[model samples]
Target: MELENIRRRKQELLVEIQRLREELSEAMSEVEGLEANEGSKTLQRNRKMAMGRKKFNMDPKKGIQFLVENELLQNTPEEIARFLYKGEGLNKTAIGD
Candidate 1:
């Protein structure tokens, strides 16, 4: 009778262990999914640059001459912003504005 009880207890323990293992696997899967989602949600360099684009759009003028001269106007606002403080001849040396 005692041996039978021991066998039954052993069976119960195995079942409990298996259930715990399954729960752990599910938790690991959820962690992996969360990591994947976080990676996907990461912002691209272009998006970050776009956010910083507001500083470059200096003048209100829009034309071929403006584009050729400024060069920033040729691209999107983001691009213009990245190159805002960069490069030479951004400002004209004219005596008057």
Candidate 2:
């Protein structure tokens, strides 16, 4: 009985480790995507700055629009916002406003 319990616990731990590895892989891929797009983002940001726009002053709505317009993100505004903000995305009224 003791050995069987240990084996079951070991199996559970292995499953958890596999899950963590998958999560880590996903995070790494996201980082790689961000790095790959960094150059374009920088150039666009610089252009906006040259036109007197402050870099960090963009609200969520405008930021979503800019990302879509610039083709920086292929997803819908809500999806992108949720991805970027981790589910703190704007409401429908907020987007309209």
Off by over 4 Å in 2: 45-97
Residue-by-residue lDDT tens digits, candidate 2, 4-90: 999999999999999999999999999999997997889877674333222113454565556556555555757565535542333
Every model's TM-score: 0.49, 0.44
> What's the lDDT for all of these models?
0.53, 0.61
The sequence of per-residue lDDT tens digits that candidate 1 reaches over residues 1-97 is 9999999999999999999999999999999999987776564433433333322234323322354354424566664444444533333322112
After TM-score superposition, the amount by which residue 33's alpha carbon in candidate 2 deviates from its true location, in angstroms, is 1.1
Minimal lDDT window, size 10, model 2 = 49-58
Q: How many residue pairs clash in each candidate?
A: 0, 0
The residue pairs found clashing in candidate 2 are none
Q: What are the clashing pairs of model 1?
A: none
